[model samples]
Target: MKELMKGNEAFAEAAIRAGCRFFAGYPITPQSEVLEYLSRRMPEVGGVFIQSESELAGISMVYGAAAAGFRAMTSSSGPGYSLLQEGISYIASAELPCVVMDVMRYGSGLGDIFTGQSDYWQAVYNGGHGDYRTIVYAPSSVQEMADLTVMAFGKAEERRNPVTILSDASISQMMAPVELPAMACHDPDAPAWALKGKGNGHFKRHTSVMYYMNEYDGYVRAKYEKIEKEDQRWESLETEDAEIVLVAYGISSRICEEAMRSARAQGRRVGLIRPISLYPYPVNAFDGLAPRAFLSVEMSALGQMARDVALACGMRAPVYSMLGGTRLYSCSDVEARIGEILGAAHGAF
Candidate 1:
């Protein structure tokens, strides 16, 4: 059944349903409600909720708990997310399974307590260091907040890597009616490769790389290659004969959906393709769609996905973008752009 709730409330419920037993976080604007709600709910379900001193410490605590085979998570805004990147990198290198919510707010440096997609580049492209990649799940609404929370944990455990439920404060603070799925108890054993302790001294320990060598590079490469094969999801609408395709993710995609509907009302044949998972990008989906013109709409200033889409779809489809270090455009602004692009491209098709 669905309930009318804030995005933060849905986020907490989803985590609980995903069998998250441990949550550690530092309160920050836009995302504190997630911590507050989980602080109460986690304990009621015989789980753990810890409010740490800083985002750095909070993520470390999550790393520790996840290492012990408990589903765990942490939430923060742009600044706090930056603080946690170091811990996130360590969690990546250690191959620990965990989820992080980045309810992004405006900022290159102290942007403010407002909504912004500035963290798009950081979340998917590596804010901390190294070649590590985290599965980034962008949810546009309250329902996605909860649904993506569960999906994030499952992806993290499956990949033995970090996963992020990336969103802007607009989404975090917004209230919407969201139909939640039936809550299911988390199954720790659902993941096959979950590091489950030393196993009664009968198995070798899963240790972080202490000694780096050429072979380790190859080993990491193989793991990433396997990840590319296994992890990928992108949703589409009416692309069977679409000449112009709109590519968006997270909240921007939600906006794009509204834009698409309006454009259709005006007799445009535009469509939208939403990438549910950003790290293992759906390159094949891009290829299969094969639209004449592709445009990207998002909340960041021309970040990771746009470039990734270009590479996958090739220059055959010219790409236009309307995202940056500025405010996100509205449904009208995006609809007009997509309408123009689709109209121009439709002529050629």
Candidate 2:
């Protein structure tokens, strides 16, 4: 049904609909509503909901649930997500199918409960240890929170890898109209590798990454390469004939969308590339936009995404970064930044 729903609530409903039978999480701001909503709804739907003592414990529980061949998930913010890193790495190593949602908040250590994009690097690149990547989704709106979450689960299960929904306080707390999908039933058939009890008359084999190190490394690399080729997702706007392009993701993409409209109206040639899959990172988005200056806008003190843009563009164009920190950019702010970059380039002319 169509209704005005908070992003957290929308995502919780989506998880349920996506056949997420197990939810394990610790409450953290900007995302606490997800846990709270799931807590009340899970029991009604015959699902397991666990309020773990700590973020570490919560992700550990998710790991166990996922290993059992169930659609499992967890949610948290910055520091809490930091605590889940080891478990995430283990999940990656074991190639477990699961979903993790991070409603990003500010700071290195409990900076603030406010929204921030500082976690982009952590979400897309260094989620955990030992050269692995998860399918990361950046949702800009409440509706996308629901939609991409369903996609996240599907992708994780399809690839037998973990997927992350990397949102922020703005997207997590914002309310917007959304249509909930019909709930799907969770399947209980254990995978060939899943442990079955002794009485079940099956060989109970446990999942682990302890094998030939070289072979394991090669296997992981091959899997990631296939994901990179097939899973890169992005939206390009006005880039076919433009001098300046703005690259962004998550909520910043929404702001840039507005800015693009305004800039086009004002006769300033500005385009945009919004990355929906941050891990695979739409490098193709930068394929032909050479001889143009690029602006990477993000909500961080340093432009973590700009680094990726530079690499994707092959250092052919000058890439600039605008760090918004915890503050969201107004359309005017984006236009002004575009003007600054364009004007500076013109001055060089």
The top-ranked prediction according to lDDT is 2
Residue pairs with clashing backbones, model 2: none
Predicted structure with the largest TM-score when compared to the true one? 2
C-alpha positional error of residue 263 in candidate 1 after TM-score superposition, expressed in Å: 1.3
lDDT of 1 at 244: 72
- Reference-based TM-score of each model: 0.89, 0.95
lDDT of 1 by residue, 1-349 (tens): 5688888889888888888999999998989998889878988999999999999899999987877778989999988999989988988888888999899887777778877777878887879988688888888788878888888887888788899888887778888988775666775555443456656755534446535445778788888788777777778876667767888886778788888888777767778888877777777677666677788877766454688778868777798877755666899999777766766765632
How much lDDT does candidate 2 score? 0.86
Q: Which residue runs does candidate 1 get wrong by more than 4 Å?
A: 186-207, 210-214, 342-349
> Candidate 2 on 1-349: residue-level lDDT in tens?
6889999999999999989889999988989999899999999888999999998999999988887778899999999998888888888878788899999988788789888899988888865778778889998888888889998988998888889999988898998999887777767575644543656585554455645355876788889999999999888999878789899888888999999899999888889999989988899888867646988999998788899988999888799998887566787899998888888989842
What is the Cα-based TM-score of model 1? 0.89
Root-mean-square deviation (CA) per prediction: 3.0, 1.7
